[model samples]
Target: MPPLFKHPNFVHFWIGQIASSFAFQMLSVGIGWQMYDLTNSPMALGLVGLCQFLPQLLLTLVVGHVADRYNRRLICVCTRFTMAMTVGILAYGNITDSISANMIYLCAALLGTARAFEMPANQAILPNLIPNELLSRAVSAIASAREISVIAGPALGGLIYLIGPTTLYLSSMSCFLVSCVIMFFLHYNFTVKTKSPISMEHLFGGLRFIRGNKVILGSVSLDMFAVLLGGATALLPIVAKDILHTEAWGLGLLRCSPAVGALLMSIYLARRPLTHSVGKIMFAAVAVFGVATILFGLSENLILSMIALVLLGSSDMISVVIRSTLVQLETPDDMRGRVSAANSVFIGSSNQLGEFESGVTAAWFGVVPAIIVGGVGTIAVVGLWMYLFPNLLKRDTLEQ
Candidate 1:
């Protein structure tokens, strides 16, 4: 048997992640589609991102502290339950025709609250479930599974949305419920030692630790800046409706194309794997992502747009694998939750803030110009980061 799938715990975790990811993807697609249908404005989609990420940014430090001081499994279970309840409420609203933009914003805020705690716990627990030798492969497998969910979920949601938005919401709720059950059965021997009292001092400690780690800081900064600048997902509705002249199904394909490319690349990575030159790979892949985004913005043809999205997805996946492996390998076990929380801040900021940037830019300078400029800015940021962080650029292997 392959070392990557050797542990039952890892297998269970993988299954649970797959289920949750699929449901999450459905919720994402449904929300965007419904919001656009209601408001017909790019800013409304951006607002959705804002509502979801603001809580994560504000609460990440506290959540990280709690994760480190408590049983991670307990944290995961509680967060999942919270998320399920939020989805259930959204589902009820949708089914009864009471769904409104305001209701979605409220639900999104609740979901964000759950995510602030859930992300760190999820990132930290994976290492505890497997041996170090298998860690990189495990991360790759999980990324691949997520990519698969991205590929399948949006397409499915798009088709299901044609039937009704409630269908997708209900499906997402079920996935979360099932995930909670699966999480309950997982067995692990994890225990937090010497629970520290919550204080400003402990929170400061996490910030100081992250500040001192140059490689970790640089890698995360690179990812954050690039995504913040080049991400065009929030304006995908504009591209789908105005540029590509398509409907909900087309919107779903546009969203799913990147994941399709990402899943394919992830599969290749899992098979051969890249044990070195990861930094260089990440840099080049992000550059490719920028170029793809530019092409996507420029193209009016649906086929061309899909191609661009696919390349963007492929490049983004490469960066994700490299950064995640680096973070997991370098972080100390005790500090994993805190560091992962910091990671969530960077990631959440990039995604949510990027949406805001895209929406405002699109509203001001036209959608195509906004997307093109964002891509150009992304490429420039990568070049600048490479020049500034020479050591980071040369980091070819995961820290031992």
Candidate 2:
């Protein structure tokens, strides 16, 4: 058997994530479409991001603590079930023609709550599934799967939305249910070790640890600032409707363009694998991402926009793989959950909070201006991060 498929747990987890990711992409596009259909406001779309992420921020510490204290697989199963139920409720509302913006908001909030627990569990469990030697490849493969989902899911969602929002919700619910079943087969003997009693002291220990680890902190900080400044995903609806003059199907294609680029690149990386010079490569890729974002912001033509988004996706994937590999390699087993939680907070904030920033900026400055400014800001952030973390830039491998 190929090394990638050697571990049943890895196979199951990858397949399950692909299925769930595809559904998630659909749900994401569907939600944006539904929100725009209801309110036609950029700020309203941003509000969706806010509703989803607020719970993640609120529950990050608690979830991290609990993940370390319980069976990771069980936590995953319960959270998947919760998400399934949430999707079902959303489906019911859509089918009954009773779907309101407020109802969607409530559903989003509940999903966020579930995710608060799910994210940390998912990150902390991966190292246990694959050997350390294969960690980089595993992360790359996972990135590829996500990229594939990004490519396929939104397009599917856009097509389904043409049929009706109910179809999208129903499909998403089915995906979630499948994920739950797949998770049931994840056999791992991860037991929480007994430690000192829970207290504020222990909680602060994780923070202190992260603070001391400059490599992890630097990589994560670079990602956070870059995504925060350059993320234009929240403004995609506006671009699809007003700037590009595209229909639902076109919107779907536009959404998937970046993922398609990322997917292709991920396949290449998985085959060749970069074991050294990851730091320099990551910085360059992020810089390219900024450039792509800038071009995307300037382009009104559909083809040009698609090309730009693809470039953006490809570049972003490189950074993601490198950063994730660093985190996995540097973190010890006992501290994995807490560190993963911090990573989640950084990533979740960069994405969701970035969405909020995009919406608010778009509301004030118009869509084009918002995206352009974001791209430029991202480039500036890259420069600043590189300057601040000279030691990180010089480091060649996580083995250090």
Please give each candidate's TM-score. 0.88, 0.88
- lDDT of model number 2: 0.85
Error of 2 at 149 (Å): 1.9
Clash count of each predicted structure: 0, 0
lDDT by residue (tens digit), candidate 1, 32-148: 999999889978987898898888889978888877877887788788888888888877987788888999899999998998898998899898998876777788899899988
Each candidate: RMSD: 2.9, 3.0
Model 2 TM-score (2 dp): 0.88
Which pairs clash (backbone N, Cα, C closer than 3 Å) in model 2?
Answer: none
Candidate 2 residue runs with Cα over 4 Å from true position: 29-46, 92-102, 158-168, 235-252, 298-302, 356-373
* lDDT for each residue of candidate 2 in 139-218, tens digit (9 for 90 to 100): 88888888777767777888998988888888898998898899888988886598779997666555667788888888
In model 1, what is the error at residue 400, expressed in angstroms? 2.7
lDDT of 1: 0.85
